[model samples]
Target: MKRKATAVWKGAGKTGKGTLSTQSGVLKDSNYGFSSRFEDGEGTNPEELVGAAHAGCFSMKLAFVLQENDFEAEEINTESQVILEDGAIKEVFLITKVKVAGLENDKFTEMVNDAKDNCPISKLLDAKINLEAELL
Candidate 1:
């Protein structure tokens, strides 16, 4: 499987602006720039996009893992915090609250850990992965 996104930037680094377009069209021509990325600006940024992807990816992976264990998640809410420090992504913190019936807390924690460790984005990121999971 393959996916692609395009970025177009013009002018100087600090003052320049850019637009990001994804093949899926979900993020077509989204605005991004130095202000939007490093400061509060009316646009999206790379870290925000990465956080969304990580959250979505982790959720889906957990669903599949639960299915494999003969269980199903009633709901899985995951929030990813991509910590950027020293101009690099130092860590990804995955905070999740799951609602699954008839699943032991220990088993659920195991599955959550597995999903956090094995999710595609998680595997791709060369940074520390921290998780806070609640089996509600």
Candidate 2:
């Protein structure tokens, strides 16, 4: 399956404004500009979107990994931090909190590591990946 999003930009780099649209329409003609990406602004940016996608994908992968190990999680919250350095993405840090019943620490850690290494998004990223998992 393939998903697509389109971005349209006009004018010069610093002064140009852009709109990003996704196939699902969640970002239909959403605003993105230099201020939005480089400075604090109300518009959306690519790094923010990447963080959201990474977090969502990691959470889902963690859930599946837990279930596969016979340890169903009650809640899984993941936060992905993408760091950009020298105009390129440098690292992706995943901080996850999981609430599961009847799962030991060692086993849970193993599963979390497996999910971090095997998740599709994680595999796709060339940046360094860091994960922190906790059971609550």
Candidate 3:
């Protein structure tokens, strides 16, 4: 099976006010533990959450880049696919899109790379990162 992570961003970065979600369906007022072996679980595992964080962080980082460039992204969506190999996270595939006016593909790609390279999550991982980006 494959695990994936995704995040979406809209409008300005500062304009983003968000909510929180817990894997055990909101651990509020509840005891938490594991129910299954390493093979399975009732909730998500660390790998999935890591991918999800990478996606969210990438989107926000891209948003920051846009805002810094005096541009506002109408929306941005990013998906990160995490691959585990040899008992380690081997690679991450990032697919992302941005909708901003008058932005060249080259510069957009540059900014995307910048975010991919600089996001805290990305910095934490020691895997090869590949990206596909689109500007609309």
lDDT of 3: 0.74
Clashes of each: 0, 0, 0
Give the alpha carbon lDDT tens digit for every residue of 58-101 in model 1.
Answer: 99999999999999999999999999999999998999999999
lDDT of 2 by residue, 86-133 (tens): 999889999999999999999989998999998898888889999988
RMSD of each: 0.6, 1.0, 12.5
* Tens-digit per-residue lDDT, 1-136, candidate 3: 5433333334443433222245445422221123211345344545666688899999999899888988889999999898878879999998998889988888888889999999888999999999999887
Using TM-score as the yardstick, the better of models 2 and 3 is 2
lDDT agreement with native, every candidate: 0.95, 0.91, 0.74
Judged by lDDT against the true structure, how good is candidate 2?
Answer: 0.91
Pick the lDDT winner.
1
- Which 10-residue window in model 1 sums to the lowest lDDT? 33-42
Q: Indicate which candidate wins on TM-score.
A: 1
For candidate 3, the 10 contiguous residues with the lowest summed lDDT are 28-37
TM-score ranking, best first: 1, 2, 3
Tell me the TM-score of each prediction against the true structure.
0.98, 0.95, 0.71
